[model samples]
Each structure stands twice: as C-alpha cells, then as structure tokens.
Target chain A: MILDPDLPLIDRILAGEQNVFAELINRHKQYAYTIAVKILQNRPEAEEAAQDAFIKAYQNLAGFNRQARFSTWLYRIVFNTSISYKRKNNKVFQSIENTVIVYNHEGEVSLEKTDKTRYLNQAMMKLNEADRTALTLFYLDEFSLDEIADITGMQANTVKVRIHRARQRLADELKILLNHEALTL
Target chain B: MNRLSQAQEDILLEYLDGTLAAPAKIKLEEELRVNALLRLRLDELRAVHTIFQHASLAEPSRDFTARVMQKLDTAPSPTPSRWPIRNAIFLLIGVLTAIGAAALLIASGVFDGSTSISLNDSSLPQKIIQQEIPVFTFSGKLIINIIIMLNIVVGWILLDRAILRPYFQRRMQA
Candidate 1:
C-alpha cells in the first residue's frame, strides 16, 4: 500500500499542531477500534483502548520511525494498548456465550446476516486471543504476514505458522460448532 | 472437516495463500493432480480461507473521535522542560561533586594508616615557618556549614525531581 497521505499531517502534529491530530484519529479509529474489539471482545473497552492508543501515538509521534508504514506503527500501538487494557481489566474476560457477533449496526445486517455468519462468529470467539487476532488480521486482507508480524511482534514465518494453525483451529471450531450445518458452506 | 497433519497443513496453507515458492507450488500441484484426497483437503482449506476472509469487523462508537479528542484535551501535557534533561544535569553535578570529594578524602590519607587525625607525631612534617595554606582557611565550623548548605540544595532537588515530580505524574495519570 502507498504511504498514508496523512504522514505529512503527522509531521505537522509532531511540530506542535496538536489539533491536527484529530484527523489522524478520524482516519484510523474504525479499524483501530475493530482490532481492539476483536482482541478484547468488548465494545466499550475496545473503544477506550483505541482511544488510549491514539493518545499514546500522539505522545510518542516524535519517536515513530518514518520508514515504517504509519498504520503498521499505529496498529502495533492499538494491539499493545489493547493487551494492556485486557490485563488491567482481567475481570472482563468472560464466557463468549453472551457476546454476539456484530455486523454493522443492529438493523443494517440484511445482506451480511446469515446462519453461517453466526456460526463463524461463535467459532471465532472460541479461539484464543492470539489465534483470533491472527485470523482477524489475515481476514482483514489489509496486512501481509510481515506487516501482521510487525504489528504483533512476531516473526514473519512465525506469523505465517500462526495464521495457518489459527485457520485450522477456526475451521475445526466451525465444523464442531455447526456440525452438519457446516455442509451448507 | 478434520485437522490436517502439521506437515501437510503447512504445505497446503502455504499453497492456498500463494506463499509457496514456485518450486514448492509446482511440487504441490503435481501431488494434487494425482492425489484425490489432497485435492479434497485443499478444497476444504479453501472454503475455510474464504470464511475467514469475509469475517465481519466491529464498528466503533459514533463519537469515537470526539471521545478521543476529549481525552487528549484532559490528558496532562507532558510538563514543559521535561525532567529527563534536568535530571541528567543534576546527576552529572552530583557525580562530579562525589568524585571530587572522594579524591580529596583519599589524598588526605584519612582512610590509610590510622582512623584518627592526631597531628602529634605523624609524618605530616610541620613547616618551620608555616605558610598560610590558602586564602580561606579550612576549619571545623566552616566544613560543617558548607556540608549543611550542600545538604539543603541536594534535598531540594531530590524533593523536586524524585519525590514531587513522580507524585504529581501519578496524579495526572489517574
């Protein structure tokens, strides 16, 4: 992918135009929040963690190496910040029984909603955090294994292995969760 | 529908993801042409890949940006004149002063021969006509006064940088 055009705005913000940082936040907040929610599996905490990550990126913008993709760097922060948030709020780790897979807003799911989607969501929640994150990043189709490795601090081949194993596990989970229903896919 | 063996899974995954090198891809393709089970396995993995590729992502709250901006507004601006620079200066002065004081103590032979400084019969020969040592004489009261002043200055800096600075920083984070 081409370098974010917002990199210049980042330069401006680092030079002390703090208000301009709002644009960066607006640009990345959705995927950042999506990443956090995928890991934390909670909407509010994901929102807070994403916010915290942006705040941290703002604080450390001066130290951010320019050669790296800004999204790679920012997503790394989101990933790490969400992990810390998870650790700090360890009590929030609960059974996935209550968490519903969200597809757009509640009423916007006409085309996207299906039994297959529901089963896949259930299977995803059953996967461990690392596997879930690996699968999510892989499925997002926005990052290569190397970029995913950078974001998650794993080696590229390790990321490949992880995605491979996680995919297998997710497939196994979907098969087990859906039983005969999986044949429809 | 079942788990693939570690080796088989790795090859198949690499092939499915198009990450298999040309040689490996050629090998897997050759195997797939003859191996019906391998073809079925590949088809299974392909289906799984499709589902994961289409996995739904979560959406952020409508005001995520505004909430973040509000948090940024309230977050403490890192204090002006970040203490790291000031702390380095303080450490340099502290270390140099400590070294100077140590060298003086060693040169005086305070820790060598005897614990006491009895000028009575020591090899510290007296000058026949004692030249005044310096412009300012070293006396007990003067050393004590100097030490007290040094302690006060060091105390203030320690309080500011170590104690007070961290306490306020904790409060800011809270």
Candidate 2:
C-alpha cells in the first residue's frame, strides 16, 4: 500500500519522533531530488542540495505553518536549496541563448530514434531555467499549471506562458537539427 | 485568419494535454479546424510535448538514498532546547520580582533604621527622654551595633551577588 506521507508523518515528526524524520525523507526524496536535478542539472549536486533541503526542513519543522500544504513547503525548501547550491558553485544555469544545437555530422536525412531523443534532450537543456523548471514540473511530474505555479512561486498565467515558449523553442531547435541533417544528406 | 494569440496557443497546448475544460476544448477545436497556422502550431507543440513526455527520467546515483540517509544521520539532531523567548521572559520576571521586593523593603523602613542606641542615665528627665526615644547611630556605635550593620550590608551584598546579578546576567544572555 502506498503510504500517505501527509498524514501521520508530519504529526509524528512534530512530536519529537526523530525516526519519523527518516520516513519523511524516504517519502519525499524522489520529489525533492527531481526538483533539485531540474534546477542544478547535476546528480551529485542535486543529491547534496536535496539532503540539505531536508535538514533545513527538519530544523524549521516547528515554525511550519499548517496553512500551506506540507509538500508545498517542502518544494519551496528544495527549490531554494537548489538555487543556493548553484550560486555557491558559481555555475551559470544553461540559458537559451547559450544552447549549442548539436546535429549529426554524417549527411543522413532520416532521423534515428536515438538522434530525435538526443535532439529533444539537448533542446530541453537550452531552455531558460524558469521554462525548464516549469516544463519539468508540468509534463514530467504531471502537475497542473496551478500546481506548477505554486511550486515555482509564479503566477499560473506566467507558468502557462513559460511552458508555451519552452515548447516553441524546442520545436524550433528540432526543426533546425532536422534541416541541418537534411542539408548534409 | 488571425494568428493565434499567446493565450490561445497556451489553451491549445492545455487541450492537447487534456487539461482544458470542456467548453474551452470545444472552442479551441472549432478554431483549430478553421485556422491552418493554428493547426500547424498545435501539431508542432504536440510533437514537442510527446518528446517531453517520453524523455528519460534521470536516476540519481547508486548511493543516492544511502547518502541522503547518511547525511540525515549525521545532521545535528534538533536539540529542542527551551526557547530563548520563554527563558528571557522568566529571567525578566525574576529580576523584576527581586527589584520590587528590594524596593518594598527599603521603602517600608525594613533596612532604614540605625542599629545603635544612646542612653542618658545622669538626669531623670534625660533618662526618661532616652527611654522614650532612643538616639540611634549606625556608625561609631557599640560592637553589637557595628556587627548588626555589617550583617545587614553583607546580607544585601550576598543577595545581590547570588540572586540579582545572576538573574540580570541570564536575562542579558537571553
């Protein structure tokens, strides 16, 4: 049975049950890791950021206002922690302008499945950080635009615009790759 | 045909994702049927959306969970000590109580009177006057008077050192 982390885990953690903290970690680790990876884009750093986020969550558990959902609060921590990790490492997020459109060198017009997937991944990596985050939350996590806005601390309309722009950019990049391969062929 | 506005494009994307409401979905479908450019844009967006949906989920390192658990194990356990605000309040009340008690005692003449008494046995009237009202001196008095004054001052100093100073220090710390 899938455990309902929102119910007993929060109450137990607040009641000084330290072991329950581990349960909280186990339950939200994937969600936290996904957010961290989306922002930081590196597995090790994402792991570190996720761990730090959990520690901060544990430390500030007493101050958590129950008005917001626990998952919302936790996502806020994960997002902030990932941003801080990026800042500390001095790694500039891959911006849309800086994206390199890699194409297959051989003059092959037909697209292989792997090449299309690679092209798509590369295009995703080129998107603006906000767009990338919005798309990841919306498509991969199956979050609604409202939920994406909540996690991203942006308006729903803003998230909608971002996702639209990101999709357009991806399509444009794919078209460019496809044309470049066609020319070579 | 008017080009699809950014909002309309967003609606189309949402419709493709099956997130649009029924009325909005119908409206967008009607528009898509008439607008060739909007149809092309919708197809492109659908292609990108499909790719995004199928993108590989990046798995964390092999030791990801173990590392996270280890970090939690090593993290400083929240000590859950008494809140500084509560401690400060308790110390403030204690200091205020000590000050109030001291003020009450000083105002009530508990420590204001002298310790030594002078007696005049030479004349009956003087003796009666001395008996009726004693002329007291806290300084240059009898041994017992000096001892009593010393004891009062010593007691006050001890109380200030043992209680008042510590209370104030604790309040400041808080």
Candidate 3:
C-alpha cells in the first residue's frame, strides 16, 4: 500500500493537536494556491480562496475519510472555494501578472522567452475558466487526469477534452502573437 | 500540407506527450517528414506545450500560513453540531410550559371577571386611593386566545429552528 505523509498529521489534528495542522498547511499550501490561482486567475483572490479552503479543510478534518489522498481533498476544496469566490464576486478575468516568468535582459533568447510567456498568458486568459484551469493543472504535471477530474468535479474524459481544446487554442493564439512579433522584428 | 485533422492533432499531442504507441509514432514521423505544414503545426503545439511545461506553482504571500492560522483561531469548528437545535427545543419546552400554565390558570378561573380584588376594601386610607379598583372585566377567553396565537407563532419558529432549517441545510450540502 502507498503511504501518505499527510495522514499522520491529519490524525494528530483529528486527535486535538491543532498546531500540527500548521505543518500540513505549509506542506500543501503551494499546490492549494496553484489550484486556486488556476481557477481564479487573480492572486489576492486566489490567496483568499486558498486560505479559506485551508480553514475549511481544517474545520472538516474529522470528516475527512482517508480513502483519498489529503492533497486531492484539499485541492477539491480549493477548487470549489475559488469557483464560488469567482461567482460571488463576479470578477472579470484578472491578470496573473505576478506569476509571469521573469525576463532576464541577456539577449535574443530572453526576448523570445518573454514574448512566448506573454503570448501564453494572453492566450490563457482568452479561454474560459474551466479550459484554462484544466490545461494548467494537466501541464503542472502534479496531478493525474483522475485527480484533476476530482478537483474540478468533472469526468476524466471531459477534462481530457478540455485540456486538448485549450492547448489547441493556446497554440493558435501563440502562432498569431509570434507571427506578429516576427513581422515587427 | 493542409491543416491537420482533429484526429491527427490529437495523435501529435499524444506523440508530444510520449504516449503515442510505437507504430503510431512511426506513422506520424513519416507524415511529418513529407508534410511541412503538418510539421509547422507540430512545432507550434510543441511551443505551447513547452510554455506549460515551464508553468510553476504560484506561491501565496509570505505570511499566508500565519494568516490562515490566525483565521483558524477565530473560525468555528466544522463538525455539524446539534446544539442549536437542542437549544431551540429547550426554549420551545419552556414556552410550552408557560403556555400550559396559562391554560391551567384559565381552567382554574384565576382570570374570571368575578375574581378581582377591590381597592376600597383595602387597609389604606381613602385619601391615598380615592377611587375603588374596577373589577377586571376583560374577557379571560380573549387573553387565552392571544396567548394561544403567540404560542403558535413561537412554536412554528422553534420547529423551523430545531428541525426544518437544519434538515434543509443538510439537503443542500448533500
């Protein structure tokens, strides 16, 4: 059987050792935030949503059945929280400006890298939230299709289609952007 | 050299992901050798895939864990507690007991028109109380009816609190 590191921490929290939950939060915060950011596309809102999701996970610690991995459960919570936050706030697509790849002023390599990153970000923002999130999670290489499906509340086949479609759209957008850059150059 | 079909694109994606079987990979490679447009499309898809491959997890603010812990200190526990329902039930019982006592009083004729005391027959002087106390001629039945109505309202609210609200909330969660 596969061993889960978070299982022990979860048990401690369930047994009333509340402080250990901090370690659990720290361990999973990056991924949880990643999921939130993928869905919300806004850093501050994504942060809030991720924190709320952690608090929710903590509160519902006792109800967490160990059948699923802790990360999966936490991500699902993050996904739902971010989606609800998006709906409740009625936020327009906010740029994930902070998470963009930083460009070094080295030479032509850096310039092309920067352009590709910018094009990818713009293209990502153009797709609907589900497609963007699915593509992000799939390419993050941190989750399987099934885990992504669980986090997204979609069937695995649906997620596959979404990722496929999203990638195609991103390629099309990047082609236009790069072609424009080539023309300008 | 025309635009690739959806199936061809999917196959190229699977090839890029290293999931295409050997025969399909061989077939795709042969097509790519002959078709410049198809190869260009693959190059475009590869670039997009590379961008995603470089996508890193976004970290939260430096004090995110601290903020979450602070919030947790104030947030209520997540276990579905029955205490509110229990408290409502206790309150309903108290209200019912009060209504029952009022009903008993009605049954015992305590509020009957003939049962009031007179101030003129008191130990105090007439100068202190110039007028005799009027008999309480208000109908006992009316008082009972008002009490019953109030009790019904209270009972409905308590039932909603103790039962219906929790039930519906659970249903919504489910």
Q: Interface RMSD, all models, one decimal each?
A: 7.0, 8.2, 5.8
Model 3 quality (TM-score): 0.67
Q: Point to the candidate with the largest TM-score.
A: 3
Model 3 C-alpha lDDT per residue in residues A89-159, reported as the tens digit of each score: 76343322323422221233545545688678867867876677778788888789988888888999999
Alpha-carbon RMSD of each model: 12.2, 15.8, 13.4
Per-candidate TM equals: 0.63, 0.63, 0.67
Per-residue lDDT tens digits for candidate 2, residues A1-185, read 21234646665766667777777776678778888888887777788888889888888876654445677778778988888887777535444223322333332334463477767766676775567777887777556677678778889998887887888788878878766666656
Better of 2 and 3 by TM-score: 3
Q: Can you rank all candidates by lDDT, best first?
A: 3, 1, 2
Question: For residues A1-185, could you state the per-residue lDDT of candidate 1 as single tens digits?
Answer: 23557667875776677788889888888779888988897888888899999988877776664556888899999999998988877754643333333432243334333466666666677676666776788878888888899888889998888888777776676556555444434
Over 4 Å off, model 2: A1-4, A91-114, A141-144, B1-4, B21-24, B55-57, B79-174
Candidate 3 C-alpha lDDT tens digits along B1-174: 467889988998898899999999999999999989889989999999887888888988999999999998897665534576689999998888888888888888777653355666669977788776775545766778698789979988998778776576445434
Q: Which residue segments of model 1 deviate by more than 4 Å?
A: A1-4, A95-114, A180-185, B1-4, B78-174
Instruction: In model 2, state the lDDT of residue B97.
Output: 61
Each model's DockQ score: 0.20, 0.13, 0.28
lDDT of 2 at B17: 77
Clash pairs, model 1 backbone: none
| Local distance difference test, each candidate | 0.72, 0.69, 0.80
